[model samples]
Target: MLLAVGKAAGPEKTLTERYVERAAKAGRAMGLTGFDVRELPDGDGPTRADREAASILAKRGRGVLVALDERGKALTSEEFAAFLQGFADDARDVTFAIGGADGHPPSLRQAADHVLSLSTLTLPHQLARVMLAEQIYRAVTLCIGHPYHRV
Candidate 1:
C-alpha cells in the first residue's frame, strides 16, 4: 500500500490509478492471486510512519514485509524476479511499504523482512508508486517466462 500525500488531484491521480490497473492485470496474468492498494493519510514525522507501519502490519498478519527507501539494497530486474520467486515458492504474502516524505520510521525499517531501493536517484512518492508497480509487473513476467523483460 501507499501512504499518499492525502488525496491527489487531476493528472497525477489519473496516472497513478492507471499504473495500478496495469500492475494488477499483469500480476494476475502471471498467476498472482491479485493486487490490492491501500492509502494512509499524510503526516510530518516518524509517528506517522509508525502508524502506517502498524496499519500495514496489522493487515499483513503473517507475511514477508518489504520497505522501500533510498538506503535499501538495490537489485537488478532478474534479482528482483528471484526475490519474488522466493516468496512464491514459500506461498507467502508479500507486503510492500511506501513511506511519506519524511521517510519511514526506524521501527518500520526494523520490522521489515527486507528493505529494497528502487533507484539511487530520489523520486517523488507518486512516481515511486508507479515505478514500483511497473517493476513488480516486470518481475512477474520474468517469473512466468514471458518476454516482457528483455534481459
Candidate 2:
C-alpha cells in the first residue's frame, strides 16, 4: 500500500488523483493486486506528520517501509526494479510513505526500512505524489516482464 500524508493543495488536487488512479490501473493491468492508498491529515511540520503517517502505516501490516525523501538514497530505474523484486519476494507487503511540502519528519526517516530519493531538487509534494505513483506502476511493469519498461 502507498500511504501519502496531507491533503492535496490547490493546483495539486486533480493531478495527484489522476496519477494515483492511473497507477492503480497500471497495477491492475500487470495483475498486481492489493494496491491500497491512504491519505492522512497534513501535520504542521515534517517531523510531526511523518511520525503520524509512520504510525498509521505500522498498524497496517508488516512489510518494508520506504520513505520518499529528497535526502535519501537515489537509485536508477533498474536498481529500483531490483529493489521492488526483492521486496516482493521477501515481504508480505511494501509500504511507501510520501510526506508533505516541508518534507518527512526525522522520526519517519529513522524508522523507514529504506529512504528513497526521487531527486535532490525540491518538488512540490503534490507532484511528488504523482511521480511516486507513476514510478510504482513502472516498477510493477518492469517486475512482471511487461513491455512497458524500455531499457
Pairs in clash, predicted candidate 2: 46-105, 47-105
Q: Candidate 1, residues 45-80: lDDT per residue as tens digits?
A: 547767766766666547788888888999999999
Predictions in order: lDDT: 0.75, 0.74
In model 1, which regions exceed 4 Å deviation?
Answer: 1-12, 44-46
lDDT of 1: 0.75
Per-prediction RMSD in angstroms? 2.4, 2.8
lDDT for model 2: 0.74
TM-score per prediction, in order, is: 0.84, 0.80
Q: What is the lDDT of residue 58 in candidate 2?
A: 62
Using lDDT as the measure, the top candidate is 1
